[model samples]
Target: MKPIYKRIVLKLSGEALAGEKGLGIDTNTIMRIAKEVKTIQKMGVEIAIVVGGGNFWRGVSAKEMDRTTSDHMGMLGTVMNALALQDALEKLDVITRVQSAIDMKQIAEPYIRRRAIRHLEKKRIVIFAAGTGNPYFSTDTTAALRAAEIEAQVILVGKKGVDGIYDSDPKLNRLAKKFETLNYIDILNLGLKIMDSTATSLCMDNKIPLVVFGIDEPNNIIDVINGKKIGTHVKED
Candidate 1:
Protein backbone atom coordinates (compact mmCIF):
# COMPACT_ATOMS: atom_id res chain seq x y z
CA MET A 1 0.00 0.00 0.00
CA LYS A 2 1.23 3.49 -0.77
CA PRO A 3 1.67 5.87 2.13
CA ILE A 4 -0.26 9.12 2.00
CA TYR A 5 2.44 10.99 3.89
CA LYS A 6 6.04 10.95 2.76
CA ARG A 7 7.34 12.33 6.05
CA ILE A 8 5.67 12.25 9.48
CA VAL A 9 6.39 13.28 13.03
CA LEU A 10 4.98 10.78 15.50
CA LYS A 11 4.10 12.27 18.91
CA LEU A 12 4.04 9.59 21.57
CA SER A 13 3.21 10.31 25.17
CA GLY A 14 5.49 8.58 27.67
CA GLU A 15 2.43 7.07 29.26
CA ALA A 16 1.79 5.26 25.99
CA LEU A 17 5.22 3.65 26.34
CA ALA A 18 4.29 2.45 29.86
CA GLY A 19 1.87 -0.10 28.48
CA GLU A 20 -0.96 -1.29 30.79
CA LYS A 21 0.92 -0.44 33.99
CA GLY A 22 0.95 3.27 33.15
CA LEU A 23 4.44 3.82 34.64
CA GLY A 24 8.06 3.43 33.60
CA ILE A 25 9.21 1.66 30.43
CA ASP A 26 7.53 -1.55 29.29
CA THR A 27 9.95 -3.76 27.41
CA ASN A 28 7.29 -5.82 25.64
CA THR A 29 5.28 -2.76 24.73
CA ILE A 30 8.34 -0.89 23.45
CA MET A 31 9.23 -3.87 21.31
CA ARG A 32 5.71 -3.93 19.89
CA ILE A 33 5.89 -0.23 19.09
CA ALA A 34 9.30 -0.72 17.51
CA LYS A 35 7.96 -3.45 15.25
CA GLU A 36 5.15 -1.22 14.08
CA VAL A 37 7.53 1.64 13.45
CA LYS A 38 9.71 -0.73 11.46
CA THR A 39 6.69 -1.66 9.38
CA ILE A 40 5.99 1.96 8.49
CA GLN A 41 9.62 2.74 7.69
CA LYS A 42 9.60 -0.19 5.29
CA MET A 43 6.81 1.64 3.44
CA GLY A 44 9.39 4.26 2.40
CA VAL A 45 8.02 6.94 4.74
CA GLU A 46 10.45 9.16 6.62
CA ILE A 47 9.68 8.91 10.34
CA ALA A 48 10.78 11.23 13.16
CA ILE A 49 9.60 10.77 16.75
CA VAL A 50 9.05 13.06 19.75
CA VAL A 51 8.24 11.30 23.01
CA GLY A 52 6.75 12.83 26.20
CA GLY A 53 7.84 12.28 29.80
CA GLY A 54 4.44 11.99 31.49
CA ASN A 55 5.02 8.39 32.49
CA PHE A 56 8.19 9.01 34.48
CA TRP A 57 7.54 12.55 35.69
CA ARG A 58 5.34 15.62 35.24
CA GLY A 59 7.04 18.94 35.97
CA VAL A 60 3.82 20.89 36.47
CA SER A 61 2.23 18.36 38.80
CA ALA A 62 4.93 18.55 41.43
CA LYS A 63 4.05 21.50 43.60
CA GLU A 64 6.94 21.22 46.02
CA MET A 65 9.72 21.32 43.45
CA ASP A 66 11.04 24.37 41.69
CA ARG A 67 9.45 24.68 38.29
CA THR A 68 12.70 24.80 36.35
CA THR A 69 14.21 21.94 38.29
CA SER A 70 11.09 19.86 37.88
CA ASP A 71 11.00 20.60 34.19
CA HIS A 72 14.65 19.70 33.78
CA MET A 73 13.94 16.39 35.48
CA GLY A 74 11.10 15.88 33.07
CA MET A 75 13.47 16.51 30.19
CA LEU A 76 15.80 13.88 31.54
CA GLY A 77 12.88 11.48 31.67
CA THR A 78 12.25 12.06 27.98
CA VAL A 79 15.89 11.26 27.23
CA MET A 80 15.53 7.98 29.09
CA ASN A 81 12.45 7.15 27.08
CA ALA A 82 14.30 8.09 23.92
CA LEU A 83 17.18 5.77 24.73
CA ALA A 84 14.80 2.93 25.49
CA LEU A 85 13.02 3.41 22.20
CA GLN A 86 16.37 3.66 20.40
CA ASP A 87 17.39 0.33 21.86
CA ALA A 88 14.12 -1.30 20.87
CA LEU A 89 14.28 -0.02 17.31
CA GLU A 90 17.92 -0.99 16.93
CA LYS A 91 17.16 -4.49 18.14
CA LEU A 92 14.68 -4.74 15.28
CA ASP A 93 17.52 -4.01 12.83
CA VAL A 94 16.16 -0.55 12.15
CA ILE A 95 18.86 2.11 12.08
CA THR A 96 17.87 4.77 14.63
CA ARG A 97 19.35 7.90 16.18
CA VAL A 98 18.47 9.70 19.40
CA GLN A 99 18.94 13.45 19.42
CA SER A 100 18.47 15.32 22.66
CA ALA A 101 17.57 18.97 22.85
CA ILE A 102 19.76 19.19 25.91
CA ASP A 103 23.27 18.01 25.18
CA MET A 104 24.07 14.47 26.26
CA LYS A 105 26.89 13.49 23.98
CA GLN A 106 27.62 10.28 25.86
CA ILE A 107 24.22 8.86 25.04
CA ALA A 108 22.38 10.94 22.45
CA GLU A 109 23.69 13.29 19.82
CA PRO A 110 22.89 16.95 20.39
CA TYR A 111 20.02 18.06 18.19
CA ILE A 112 21.09 19.53 14.86
CA ARG A 113 18.41 20.30 12.29
CA ARG A 114 20.42 19.68 9.14
CA ARG A 115 21.91 16.49 10.55
CA ALA A 116 18.48 15.21 11.57
CA ILE A 117 17.06 15.82 8.14
CA ARG A 118 20.04 14.08 6.62
CA HIS A 119 19.39 11.06 8.83
CA LEU A 120 15.78 10.93 7.65
CA GLU A 121 16.88 11.19 4.02
CA LYS A 122 19.02 8.13 4.64
CA LYS A 123 15.97 6.22 5.98
CA ARG A 124 17.03 6.39 9.63
CA ILE A 125 14.41 7.07 12.25
CA VAL A 126 15.38 9.99 14.50
CA ILE A 127 13.95 10.25 18.02
CA PHE A 128 13.89 13.77 19.47
CA ALA A 129 14.00 14.24 23.21
CA ALA A 130 14.53 16.80 26.06
CA GLY A 131 11.55 19.01 25.24
CA THR A 132 13.04 21.91 23.31
CA GLY A 133 15.94 22.17 25.78
CA ASN A 134 13.83 24.54 27.84
CA PRO A 135 11.89 24.28 31.08
CA TYR A 136 8.38 25.51 30.19
CA PHE A 137 7.79 23.69 26.91
CA SER A 138 5.97 20.37 26.54
CA THR A 139 7.01 17.56 24.22
CA ASP A 140 3.99 18.33 22.07
CA THR A 141 5.66 21.59 21.20
CA THR A 142 8.83 19.68 20.51
CA ALA A 143 6.98 17.47 18.03
CA ALA A 144 5.53 20.50 16.26
CA LEU A 145 8.87 22.30 16.19
CA ARG A 146 10.69 19.26 14.88
CA ALA A 147 8.04 18.60 12.27
CA ALA A 148 8.46 22.12 11.01
CA GLU A 149 12.22 21.84 11.04
CA ILE A 150 12.09 18.60 9.08
CA GLU A 151 9.27 19.78 6.82
CA ALA A 152 7.12 16.82 7.72
CA GLN A 153 3.91 16.26 5.80
CA VAL A 154 1.95 15.66 9.01
CA ILE A 155 2.14 14.87 12.69
CA LEU A 156 0.73 11.55 13.86
CA VAL A 157 -0.31 11.73 17.48
CA GLY A 158 -0.31 8.20 18.88
CA LYS A 159 -2.54 8.27 21.91
CA LYS A 160 -3.13 5.37 24.25
CA GLY A 161 -6.82 4.65 24.96
CA VAL A 162 -8.58 7.53 23.26
CA ASP A 163 -8.79 7.35 19.47
CA GLY A 164 -9.59 10.97 18.62
CA ILE A 165 -10.14 14.47 19.86
CA TYR A 166 -13.30 14.87 21.94
CA ASP A 167 -15.20 17.87 23.22
CA SER A 168 -14.44 16.75 26.76
CA ASP A 169 -12.41 14.08 28.50
CA PRO A 170 -13.81 10.86 27.05
CA LYS A 171 -12.48 8.80 29.95
CA LEU A 172 -14.49 10.86 32.44
CA ASN A 173 -17.50 11.76 30.32
CA ARG A 174 -19.00 8.98 28.29
CA LEU A 175 -21.22 11.49 26.52
CA ALA A 176 -18.31 13.47 25.14
CA LYS A 177 -18.45 14.08 21.41
CA LYS A 178 -15.72 12.76 19.11
CA PHE A 179 -14.68 14.95 16.18
CA GLU A 180 -13.66 13.17 12.99
CA THR A 181 -12.43 16.37 11.41
CA LEU A 182 -11.55 19.76 12.82
CA ASN A 183 -9.73 22.97 12.08
CA TYR A 184 -6.83 24.40 14.11
CA ILE A 185 -8.84 27.49 15.06
CA ASP A 186 -11.62 25.30 16.44
CA ILE A 187 -9.08 23.40 18.51
CA LEU A 188 -7.77 26.59 20.10
CA ASN A 189 -11.14 28.32 20.48
CA LEU A 190 -12.88 25.24 21.85
CA GLY A 191 -9.84 24.37 24.03
CA LEU A 192 -9.79 20.75 22.92
CA LYS A 193 -7.37 18.39 24.69
CA ILE A 194 -5.71 17.30 21.47
CA MET A 195 -2.47 19.15 22.17
CA ASP A 196 -1.16 22.09 24.15
CA SER A 197 -2.06 25.49 22.72
CA THR A 198 1.54 26.24 21.78
CA ALA A 199 1.84 23.08 19.75
CA THR A 200 -1.54 23.56 18.08
CA SER A 201 -0.71 27.17 17.23
CA LEU A 202 2.63 26.16 15.74
CA CYS A 203 1.01 23.56 13.47
CA MET A 204 -1.75 25.98 12.58
CA ASP A 205 0.62 28.78 11.64
CA ASN A 206 2.76 26.38 9.61
CA LYS A 207 -0.24 24.60 8.05
CA ILE A 208 0.96 21.17 9.06
CA PRO A 209 -1.77 18.57 9.29
CA LEU A 210 -2.29 16.29 12.26
CA VAL A 211 -3.79 12.83 12.76
CA VAL A 212 -4.70 11.77 16.30
CA PHE A 213 -5.26 8.04 16.76
CA GLY A 214 -5.10 5.23 19.30
CA ILE A 215 -1.97 3.08 19.50
CA ASP A 216 -3.60 0.09 21.17
CA GLU A 217 -4.39 -1.68 17.93
CA PRO A 218 -1.79 -3.36 15.74
CA ASN A 219 -0.45 -1.61 12.64
CA ASN A 220 -2.06 1.67 13.73
CA ILE A 221 0.96 3.69 12.70
CA ILE A 222 0.88 1.97 9.34
CA ASP A 223 -2.83 2.60 9.01
CA VAL A 224 -2.35 6.28 9.69
CA ILE A 225 0.43 6.50 7.09
CA ASN A 226 -1.81 4.74 4.56
CA GLY A 227 -4.56 7.30 5.32
CA LYS A 228 -7.07 4.70 6.51
CA LYS A 229 -9.08 7.40 8.36
CA ILE A 230 -9.04 5.71 11.74
CA GLY A 231 -8.68 8.94 13.74
CA THR A 232 -9.39 12.66 14.01
CA HIS A 233 -7.77 14.80 11.34
CA VAL A 234 -6.99 18.46 12.06
CA LYS A 235 -5.99 20.81 9.27
CA GLU A 236 -6.70 24.14 7.64
CA ASP A 237 -10.29 24.82 6.77
Candidate 2:
Protein backbone atom coordinates (compact mmCIF):
# COMPACT_ATOMS: atom_id res chain seq x y z
CA MET A 1 0.00 0.00 0.00
CA LYS A 2 1.13 3.53 -0.76
CA PRO A 3 2.03 5.57 2.30
CA ILE A 4 0.10 8.70 3.10
CA TYR A 5 3.29 10.73 3.02
CA LYS A 6 5.82 10.24 0.24
CA ARG A 7 8.66 11.45 2.44
CA ILE A 8 8.57 11.12 6.23
CA VAL A 9 10.80 11.66 9.22
CA LEU A 10 10.56 9.02 11.92
CA LYS A 11 11.26 10.12 15.50
CA LEU A 12 12.04 7.22 17.82
CA SER A 13 12.46 7.38 21.56
CA GLY A 14 15.64 5.59 22.65
CA GLU A 15 13.86 3.95 25.55
CA ALA A 16 11.66 2.01 23.17
CA LEU A 17 14.46 -0.32 22.18
CA ALA A 18 15.44 -1.03 25.77
CA GLY A 19 12.90 -3.87 26.03
CA GLU A 20 12.38 -3.62 29.81
CA LYS A 21 16.11 -3.91 30.40
CA GLY A 22 16.60 -0.11 30.32
CA LEU A 23 20.33 -0.43 29.86
CA GLY A 24 21.45 -0.84 26.25
CA ILE A 25 20.07 -1.74 22.84
CA ASP A 26 18.03 -4.92 22.70
CA THR A 27 18.65 -7.03 19.60
CA ASN A 28 15.15 -8.46 19.39
CA THR A 29 13.64 -4.99 19.81
CA ILE A 30 15.96 -3.51 17.20
CA MET A 31 15.10 -6.29 14.79
CA ARG A 32 11.42 -5.60 15.25
CA ILE A 33 11.95 -1.92 14.53
CA ALA A 34 14.12 -2.76 11.54
CA LYS A 35 11.59 -5.19 10.14
CA GLU A 36 8.89 -2.55 10.47
CA VAL A 37 11.10 -0.01 8.73
CA LYS A 38 11.96 -2.54 6.04
CA THR A 39 8.30 -3.15 5.33
CA ILE A 40 7.74 0.56 4.81
CA GLN A 41 10.91 1.02 2.79
CA LYS A 42 9.61 -1.49 0.30
CA MET A 43 6.59 0.79 -0.16
CA GLY A 44 8.94 3.46 -1.59
CA VAL A 45 8.67 6.04 1.20
CA GLU A 46 11.75 8.19 1.64
CA ILE A 47 12.63 7.80 5.30
CA ALA A 48 14.77 9.77 7.70
CA ILE A 49 15.10 9.04 11.42
CA VAL A 50 15.99 11.06 14.51
CA VAL A 51 16.53 8.85 17.54
CA GLY A 52 16.82 9.95 21.17
CA GLY A 53 19.49 8.52 23.48
CA GLY A 54 17.49 8.37 26.67
CA ASN A 55 18.14 4.67 27.00
CA PHE A 56 21.83 5.44 27.43
CA TRP A 57 21.76 8.89 29.02
CA ARG A 58 19.53 11.89 29.49
CA GLY A 59 20.89 15.44 29.40
CA VAL A 60 19.02 16.43 32.54
CA SER A 61 20.45 13.41 34.32
CA ALA A 62 23.91 14.86 33.60
CA LYS A 63 23.27 18.27 35.19
CA GLU A 64 25.14 17.24 38.38
CA MET A 65 28.20 17.00 36.17
CA ASP A 66 29.59 19.88 34.07
CA ARG A 67 26.60 21.06 32.02
CA THR A 68 28.23 21.54 28.61
CA THR A 69 30.45 18.51 29.09
CA SER A 70 27.52 16.40 30.11
CA ASP A 71 25.44 17.59 27.19
CA HIS A 72 28.20 16.78 24.73
CA MET A 73 28.46 13.34 26.24
CA GLY A 74 24.73 13.01 25.77
CA MET A 75 25.15 13.91 22.11
CA LEU A 76 27.71 11.16 21.75
CA GLY A 77 25.22 8.79 23.30
CA THR A 78 22.74 9.72 20.59
CA VAL A 79 25.33 8.92 17.95
CA MET A 80 25.75 5.53 19.54
CA ASN A 81 22.01 4.89 19.28
CA ALA A 82 21.99 6.13 15.69
CA LEU A 83 24.72 3.76 14.65
CA ALA A 84 23.01 0.89 16.44
CA LEU A 85 19.78 1.59 14.60
CA GLN A 86 21.66 1.92 11.32
CA ASP A 87 23.24 -1.49 11.83
CA ALA A 88 19.83 -2.98 12.54
CA LEU A 89 18.30 -1.40 9.45
CA GLU A 90 21.12 -2.64 7.23
CA LYS A 91 20.81 -6.15 8.62
CA LEU A 92 17.22 -6.12 7.41
CA ASP A 93 18.63 -5.46 3.88
CA VAL A 94 17.58 -1.85 4.02
CA ILE A 95 20.15 0.62 2.64
CA THR A 96 20.92 3.06 5.42
CA ARG A 97 23.09 6.14 6.04
CA VAL A 98 24.18 7.76 9.28
CA GLN A 99 24.77 11.50 9.48
CA SER A 100 26.04 13.16 12.61
CA ALA A 101 25.39 16.76 13.50
CA ILE A 102 28.81 16.96 15.09
CA ASP A 103 31.92 16.32 13.03
CA MET A 104 32.41 12.58 13.43
CA LYS A 105 33.73 12.08 9.93
CA GLN A 106 35.49 8.83 10.73
CA ILE A 107 32.23 7.16 11.75
CA ALA A 108 29.51 8.99 9.86
CA GLU A 109 29.04 11.93 7.55
CA PRO A 110 28.34 15.33 9.08
CA TYR A 111 24.71 16.26 8.63
CA ILE A 112 24.49 18.21 5.40
CA ARG A 113 20.89 18.99 4.44
CA ARG A 114 21.31 18.54 0.73
CA ARG A 115 23.26 15.33 1.12
CA ALA A 116 20.60 13.89 3.42
CA ILE A 117 17.80 14.77 1.03
CA ARG A 118 19.79 13.21 -1.78
CA HIS A 119 20.04 9.99 0.20
CA LEU A 120 16.29 10.02 0.69
CA GLU A 121 15.74 10.62 -3.00
CA LYS A 122 17.91 7.62 -3.71
CA LYS A 123 15.68 5.56 -1.38
CA ARG A 124 18.31 5.18 1.31
CA ILE A 125 17.13 5.63 4.90
CA VAL A 126 19.06 8.46 6.56
CA ILE A 127 19.51 8.33 10.32
CA PHE A 128 20.24 11.73 11.89
CA ALA A 129 22.32 11.82 15.05
CA ALA A 130 24.15 14.05 17.56
CA GLY A 131 21.19 16.10 18.71
CA THR A 132 21.81 19.25 16.62
CA GLY A 133 25.58 19.08 17.35
CA ASN A 134 25.09 21.60 20.13
CA PRO A 135 24.27 21.58 23.77
CA TYR A 136 20.99 22.99 25.18
CA PHE A 137 18.95 21.44 22.38
CA SER A 138 16.85 18.29 22.55
CA THR A 139 16.59 15.58 19.90
CA ASP A 140 13.01 16.75 19.47
CA THR A 141 14.44 19.98 18.09
CA THR A 142 16.76 18.03 15.85
CA ALA A 143 13.81 16.12 14.45
CA ALA A 144 11.99 19.39 13.84
CA LEU A 145 15.01 21.06 12.27
CA ARG A 146 15.78 18.14 10.00
CA ALA A 147 12.13 17.61 9.10
CA ALA A 148 11.81 21.24 8.09
CA GLU A 149 15.08 21.24 6.18
CA ILE A 150 14.27 18.07 4.25
CA GLU A 151 10.62 19.09 3.79
CA ALA A 152 9.24 15.82 5.06
CA GLN A 153 5.49 15.53 4.68
CA VAL A 154 5.10 14.55 8.34
CA ILE A 155 6.91 13.31 11.39
CA LEU A 156 5.91 9.84 12.52
CA VAL A 157 6.72 9.67 16.21
CA GLY A 158 7.27 6.31 17.91
CA LYS A 159 6.80 7.07 21.57
CA LYS A 160 7.74 4.57 24.30
CA GLY A 161 5.05 5.36 26.86
CA VAL A 162 1.40 5.98 26.21
CA ASP A 163 0.20 5.21 22.69
CA GLY A 164 -1.43 8.42 21.47
CA ILE A 165 -1.85 12.04 22.53
CA TYR A 166 -3.80 12.14 25.76
CA ASP A 167 -5.36 14.66 28.08
CA SER A 168 -3.20 13.17 30.79
CA ASP A 169 -0.39 10.61 30.95
CA PRO A 170 -2.22 7.44 30.15
CA LYS A 171 0.31 5.37 32.01
CA LEU A 172 -0.52 7.30 35.17
CA ASN A 173 -4.09 8.33 34.51
CA ARG A 174 -6.45 5.56 33.57
CA LEU A 175 -9.19 8.10 32.98
CA ALA A 176 -7.17 10.22 30.60
CA LYS A 177 -8.83 11.24 27.38
CA LYS A 178 -7.11 10.13 24.20
CA PHE A 179 -7.40 12.15 21.05
CA GLU A 180 -7.80 10.86 17.54
CA THR A 181 -7.22 14.31 16.01
CA LEU A 182 -5.87 17.58 17.30
CA ASN A 183 -4.80 20.84 15.74
CA TYR A 184 -1.42 22.29 16.56
CA ILE A 185 -3.04 24.97 18.68
CA ASP A 186 -5.13 22.33 20.39
CA ILE A 187 -1.97 20.53 21.44
CA LEU A 188 -0.57 23.72 22.89
CA ASN A 189 -3.83 24.63 24.51
CA LEU A 190 -4.57 21.21 25.95
CA GLY A 191 -0.95 20.44 26.67
CA LEU A 192 -0.84 17.35 24.51
CA LYS A 193 2.26 15.13 24.74
CA ILE A 194 2.92 15.00 21.01
CA MET A 195 6.26 16.80 20.98
CA ASP A 196 8.01 19.44 23.02
CA SER A 197 6.69 22.99 22.76
CA THR A 198 9.62 23.99 20.57
CA ALA A 199 9.03 21.05 18.27
CA THR A 200 5.28 21.51 18.25
CA SER A 201 5.68 25.21 17.40
CA LEU A 202 8.13 24.50 14.60
CA CYS A 203 5.89 21.89 13.00
CA MET A 204 2.92 24.17 13.52
CA ASP A 205 4.66 27.06 11.78
CA ASN A 206 5.66 24.82 8.89
CA LYS A 207 2.29 23.00 8.85
CA ILE A 208 4.04 19.66 9.19
CA PRO A 209 1.85 16.84 10.35
CA LEU A 210 2.85 14.97 13.51
CA VAL A 211 1.55 11.50 14.30
CA VAL A 212 2.21 9.95 17.70
CA PHE A 213 1.97 6.18 17.99
CA GLY A 214 3.00 3.47 20.43
CA ILE A 215 6.28 1.80 19.55
CA ASP A 216 5.51 -1.12 21.85
CA GLU A 217 3.22 -2.45 19.14
CA PRO A 218 5.23 -4.68 16.82
CA ASN A 219 3.98 -3.55 13.42
CA ASN A 220 2.93 -0.01 14.36
CA ILE A 221 5.59 1.66 12.20
CA ILE A 222 4.52 -0.25 9.15
CA ASP A 223 0.91 0.47 10.09
CA VAL A 224 1.66 4.18 10.29
CA ILE A 225 3.49 4.12 6.94
CA ASN A 226 0.56 2.35 5.34
CA GLY A 227 -1.71 5.12 6.69
CA LYS A 228 -3.37 2.85 9.20
CA LYS A 229 -5.38 4.60 11.91
CA ILE A 230 -2.98 3.81 14.66
CA GLY A 231 -2.36 7.06 16.51
CA THR A 232 -3.30 10.63 17.28
CA HIS A 233 -2.92 13.07 14.38
CA VAL A 234 -1.68 16.55 15.12
CA LYS A 235 -2.12 19.03 12.27
CA GLU A 236 -3.14 22.57 11.45
CA ASP A 237 -6.92 22.69 11.48
Predicted structure with the largest TM-score when compared to the true one: 1
Report lDDT per candidate. Answer: 0.94, 0.88
Taking the tens digit of each residue's C-alpha lDDT, what string does model 2 give over 114-195?
9999999999999999989888888888998899999999999898866888888887888988899899999888776567
TM-score of each: 0.99, 0.96
How close to the true structure is residue 36 of candidate 2, measured as C-alpha lDDT?
Answer: 86
Off by over 4 Å in 2: none
What would the C-alpha RMSD of candidate 2 be, to one decimal place? 1.2
Candidate 1 on 76-183: residue-level lDDT in tens? 999999999999999999999999999889999999999999999999999999999998899999999999999999999999999999999999999999999999
**Which has the greatest lDDT?**
1
lDDT of 1 at 167: 96
